[model samples]
Target: MNRKVIITCALTGAGDTTGRSEHVPVTPQQIAESGIAAAKAGATVVHVHVRDPETGQGSRETAFYVEAVDRIRESGVDVIINTTAGMGGDLYLDPHDPTTFVEGTDLVSGVERLKHVEKVMPDICTLDCGSLNFGEGSLVYVSTPDMLREGAKRIQDLGVRCEMEIFDTGHLWFANTLVEEGLIDAPPLYQLCMDIPYGAPADSSLLASMVAQLPEGAHWASFALGRMQFPWVAQSVLLGGHVRVGLEDNLYLSKGVKATNAQLADRAKTIVEAMGSSVATPDEAREMLNLRPRS
Candidate 1:
């Protein structure tokens, strides 16, 4: 066997894709069920983000995470849980008034975003490296250096691994800074988010360059949006990193076909295996990422 690749299935995201695809999980029960289904389909980890049941928008509620995580644990499925601490940073400014915060803006302090992570204490939680133009609009996903340092310290104190989310090269630089400052624990993990609008483009050369910049002993994964999701699996593995896929970054298994979280994980498993790399089990993934032993 070549390398054992860990596959993470991101169940539901905070994107506006809920109406676009009926398969996007909206409620806490659905999120937990999707995670369980993905785990059974050979996913080593499940990245979770809760949505408001009434509005289907992403929420920062601690109770939602508590229930979702508890349900996953109660199901007895063996899979690592990775929750998103990237919420509460969405800032949508009015195009007319640049200084004014708009209705879509959800900006909050770095510590505020980790309320769910604090409550559930997942195996891993994401810490977006920096702010960036979030799409083809006035929305900017803000994560300042101060916010990052604070969040990194909080996550470090929790003993949960922080999976630094890298949207661009500059974000990668700041992530390395956090590592250098000793805020991040050993075996730092990175998630290279590609093709998400104004962030890093989905280019193999860029991915290679980014991987080369990772710190020694760092565990990493790369993912792209929509059509590139599965192809990037091969791209990430070839670069000696892991892989992530699911309804969060993508909504389809193929063109015009909506996908469930399980379907996406199964496809990723096939791609990783076809490349002569075996998929890591949950325990194997815990070892690879240096996660704290399950409590």
Candidate 2:
């Protein structure tokens, strides 16, 4: 078990959870504030995803990213920033015609999805290891091998760390292949996403299986959605990995108590302390992950 663990708070995700809980931050200012609050609450890292201010749906606007990132940097806080590059890959296959792309489809090249990442220049950016059926029905998240190579090359050139997000075993396998090909740099970072529909379930055995396959000297974190979020925090620490929690993965701190990003981070801090292990600060996390110096 890791004696000291790092906590990453995902501020908001690309899901339609704005109406589900009023605590979800919509505007750029709110997102930045939420991130700052989480950082102050003991989160070493903050994962950001921009949402449409008017609609509360996932948006890829570079202007929105600029505002939010600028706010975080100028907040006098020390949390590491991790921007999502998992957007613009959602594919909605029409039930009537397989060849006809549906209206909800936001398909784009892997490099195209990093438009905001390039402009904002966060400390880290997500690189989803592989594609799979996102959920039930015909909807799928497409990330071909070639697309991944393109994204990885560009991300490497930019001098930003890539957090490889593995949703399934196959995805993990392909991610290792990328490492073998030297696409991903050494001491790679991985985020084991659990309980996402049609992917790896939120089970102990499954998480163990994935953890056993990680590359040597990998810096990693794991999280599950909904009620399993907090439990996974303890589990990740026990398994020698870090933890992630926030409104993006779980909305409720308890059965029905809606939680803000700060509240979630606070609870995670409690859990980590209860287990007799302390949470790492941003500078500590940076040293542990061997992060590149700020530009």
- The residue-by-residue lDDT of candidate 1 on 160-239, one tens digit each, is 99999999999999999999999999999999999988999999999999998999999999999999999999999998
| TM-score per candidate | 0.98, 0.98
TM-score of 2: 0.98
Error of 1 at 37 (Å): 0.3
lDDT by residue (1-295, candidate 2, tens digit) is 8878989999989888998999999999999999999999989899999999999999999999999999999988988999999998999998889898887899899999999999999989999989889878788999999999999999989888899999999999999999899998877999999999988999999898899998899988999999999999999998999999999999998998999999999999999999989999877877887777865
Q: Which whole-number lDDT from 0 to 100 does residue 234 have in model 1? A: 94
Candidate 2 — what's its lDDT?
0.92
TM-score between candidate 1 and the true structure: 0.98
